[model samples]
Target chain A: MGNTKKNDRRDFLSKFGTAFIAGAALSPLISNASELLETENNVTEIKNFKGSFEDLLGGDYTNIKLRMQDDVRRALKKPMKDRKWAMAIDLRKCVGCNACTVACIAENALPPGVVYRPVIKEEIGTYPNVSKINLPKPCMQCDEPPCVDVCPVEATWKREDGIVVIDYEACIGCRYCMTACPYEHRMFDFGEKYSDGLPLVANYDKRPSFEYGKEWDREDRHSSPIGNVRKCTFCAHRLDEGLLPQCLTTCIGGANYFGDLNDEDSVIAKLVSRLNVFRLKEEMGTEPNVYYIR
Target chain B: MKKIFYILWGIAFILGCIGVAQRFMYGHELANYGNRVVWGLWVAMYIYFIGLSAGAFLLSSLVYVFKIKMFEKVGKLALITALVTLLCALLSIWFDLGHMWRAYEVITRPNLPHSMMAWMIWLYSAYFLLLVLETLYAFRIESGKYDGDKLKSYQKKLGILATIGIPLAIAFHGGVGALFGVVAANPMWHSALTPIFFLVGAIASGSALFTLIFAFFWDNKKGEYYQNMLKTLAKIVLVAVLFDVLLEWAELSIALWMGSPEHTAGFRAMLFGQYWYVFWIFHLLFGVVIPVWILATKKNGIAIGWASLLVAFTFIGVRLNIVVPGLIGEKIPGEASAYIQPRLTYNYFPSMMEWLVGIFIVAFGIGLFYLGNKYFKLTKENNSVKS
Candidate 1:
């Protein structure tokens, strides 16, 4: 009886998908019409993506951030499980300004020594032959994330949207995950603020930054994140609100790109499609979502 | 002499309390581990103490499982040492965790099977329970209430428990090695031989601990039987020490032969880096060579005790060598120098708070052992040896 019911449900779902796809394919001219129209979210995305002819090209549109914001809006139309968030950084455009680093700290309200994204600037070759190279390192958010595997308490895991998130409440703060991450991406929050060793901490030091769509208040000294392992979530909270990651928008060099890899039209999907783009420690077989066009 | 030891222990206990206080008040801010070298003094100490527990337990198994008559007297004492050292190991690691309060989550919401660390916690919890049960039965058998048949049955029961514990001890301590070994990202620890190396090291250090305690503190050490027992332990320690060194050489040689910098970087840093003395002077000379030479040749009980102490204590240098050097080198090229903050740098040395807390833990363990010995009269053997 159970098998018959399961088979029926599976058959119905497949049949329904087949009919809808077949009907959608018939309208070759209207192919670009919203697959997202099935959900209310997809309808809202069209409004966000479309504008007047001049308005489309205007509004301080210096670079890819504006274009990527539309891609984010489109991706947000789909259910989170269907969306695979990714990032691509063009090394040629990066000037090693450390703007992304500062922006990340400011956005996350990160305490001293807790950094999510650090732009590693290296000057290759001897002094006369020296040339600079910049690499903005974030949590690789690996398909096979070593960090998730080592977490004893099941405190951290990769979400369906390709973001690895930590349940601060559940974390025993062993920092085993920190050791396991090949890229050295995870940071232990020692509960230190910028206002540490001062007479009184400033108000900003106590303010919470929303991560994973939940406010993480550092006001209480012995609370969750204060003594927890923290890492980049690709601005998961901001993604829910159809905004690009803080580092992407604040990037002075316009070197960073963000979008959904699940969608063929998304910016990151197109960027990473190029053969020149590569991932960090590809030999480690982490299958990192973030790629670099070096 | 005892008065001097007590005074120093008292001083260490006081300092330890202060260290615990600072740990609670400041969190990991006072710790020097940072992002690069995530595991530091406490982690090394935890592994060291656990190794001691595993070693002692295995030694006790010789009396119960293998039915060795020579080590029968120290069976209760061995079980007690294993229990106390296990407690110290747990406490050391508990202090290391970010949220010590949430340690229960490891049992409640563990990432089982996949995580070697989770396996370690589960394995040790079983080991801890087994140790407690075996110690209780040893106490029962020691009470001298039962006649020959009942006593034999109890010994049989103990034999079964110790038999069960042999693999449990090996699995957990070997699992600890496998925990580091499984992290393929760190080439230094990612080896098939790591688990075997750990088991051998545990035997070497744990047997040395048993020998040290038996040689110096046992009540009937002046007796010919007691002296013979110490001599046997010296031989066991000699064999174990040699076996452990052989495995170490195999590990080092294979990594060097591989010729990958990622594999060799940790070894290079350990042998020739800033703290070369930790490996060469402390581990090689004091931990291995001096101890090995004395254990092999010395018949004097005092000399054996000193040798055992050197192996047991300087094994921390070995533990430190195992942990810190693996993390000293950068994963990405130019990554260490990429960021300039003190926390971001590759260099690490434990802070004052860390050292104080470490002293406190060892002092605390000694305090417990002292109490346990006094309460249980662990020095008194079940069957008195005729001099």
Candidate 2:
């Protein structure tokens, strides 16, 4: 029985080879037919899903997180002066899911009353004809930050990479910076807790946030950040590690985009070129790094 | 009457101690001022007291620099009041700081040319020293420490000191106004008129307070000299009140006329929002209307004293109006409803703790004033040194 089966397979292969050669010599259509037939035969060897390997290798994947991660890695290769980090948010793609806000809270270990990002919802027109817009606000990180100049202690400043950062240690928590910020992005850490009324505070609740590449324990009442004016840093710690910002990665609808604006080939640079792009309170002359695509 | 005042002081002092304990333990957790309205009752109180100090000191210049004899008896009292109020203003603001210990940073490592607050700090320090020196010089003459030629020389020294103090006082108080005025983000405070208005308000409030103190506590109130002093003080306050009202009207009418919502929002809020009564009731009714009526209608020291007291006490409402309205709105069109977190909203009213702390600072100032008045021989009649 084994000898007969081997002879039968050899006969089938010889016939298939003759047909494949004839199809390739005949026309493009026939050549495509032969290729599809061969692919079908290759699929028979797998007992599960077809085209899984081609789907991986075929370059059809368009995951924003992966694209942004690659963009960040490329950005890391450039010097700080050459890397103008910026963010572009597409309002049309935003579903107001607030995933970015939650992700930021988790990534920064933000306490209650201290939010780095908030999605503002507004209803346009009247009742039946109304439409809604969700605007997610973060720190503008202005080029000419009013908050920077108004700081009596020089606790906060603009970085070379265009991110406005606060030195929690030096901040007097006067909230003058808070008042100076037209966007009202700076928040005072009122030393509140998310687990205030709980039976016992969880260990995760006490986890120190690693902001500016330094671990900060909030348990000590006399510590720095507790009395400091706090705001978003655009996930600077993660960027230092060649990773995308938590908000960008956790964006549910891929509405948030971040990359080096200095890079001519970056996604943010491309989006910012569009006519629909704008910044909040542009008249105030803050010259914000964050842009929006309506 | 003295017993009643002492009783009131004791009650407030005890209540203030409780608030102080809460403040140290909780650290602004009990205060109603949030991230949006970062300043509240204490901040308003600071500017109020500072204005009072500036006004009183400026009025004292009338006696020292201008050599106005009608105001001579109250010059020492005004100086002492200025010092006491200045200390209270500093204390109120100090407690408002998140890290009260780091206040020295503003002095030690300040962004000098950039921050109005830094300039205010330096100017106030100079003003403080000048005030102490001026008070000592005036006390030297009043206490009969020097005779004839020496006395005249000490008076000359006071005149010189007061001359220097006039500009310093204006700079420091105007610096306070400029502190808020420099913030271009808040359109209500960004006006060039803000500092000018503060100077006028300080004069009005300070002169009103000086009038009250002189009328009620000047030791000799039944004489022709007393009546003349009271008459002159009332006239100064009346002129100041009228000038302050004119400036306030100009500020409001111009802003309202501009038709820009950003410019008018704060003014409108002051006039018609939830706390409209703060402007119309507390400030206009008690601070302006009643005082204006009494000063205009009556000519007696007792009437002017009570009316001046009303204006001086109710000016806190005016200060609050200046502060809260500038901060009580959304930056963006819908920013007010954007977030639902504690202190992230526009609605702000001082919590009980804030009120207690504010009351405590005032009570503390009153106690200091009482002690200073009783023991320092600050009054004209008590100017003699103990043998």
C-alpha DockQ of every model: 0.55, 0.50
| Residue-pair clashes, model 2 | 0
- The first chain of model 1 has a TM-score of 0.78
Model 1 lDDT tens row, B1-387: 999999999999999999999999988889999888889999999999999999999999988888788777788889999999999999999999999899898999889878999999999999999999898778778777776888888778887899999999999999999999999989999999988988999999999998999988888766887789988999989999999999999999988887789999999999999999999999999999999888888899999999999999999999999899999999988778666677778888999999999999999999999999988878765342211
CAPRI category for model 1: medium
TM-score of chain A of each: 0.78, 0.78
Q: DockQ of candidate 2? A: 0.50
What TM-score fits each model?
0.90, 0.89
Task: Report, for every candidate in turn, its global Cα lDDT versus the true structure.
Answer: 0.85, 0.83
Residue-pair clashes per prediction, in order, are 0, 0
Lowest-sum lDDT 10-residue window in model 1 chain B: B378-387
- Top candidate, metric lDDT: 1
- Which predicted model would earn the best TM-score? 1
Query: Tens digits of per-residue lDDT for model 1 on A94-210?
Result: 767788889888888888888999888887888655556889998888999999989898989999898999998898889888878889999988888777778999888998978
Model 1: pairs clashing at backbone N, Cα or C within 3 Å: none
lDDT of 1 at A216: 90
Residues B1-387, model 2: lDDT tens digits: 989998999999999999998998888788899988888899899999999999999998988888876677778889999999999999999988888889889888888789888888889999999999998888788776578888878878888999999999999999999999999999999999999999999999999988898888877667787788888889899889889989999999999987699998989999999999999999999888889999998998889999999989999998999999999978888777777887788878999999899889989998999898888756545453321
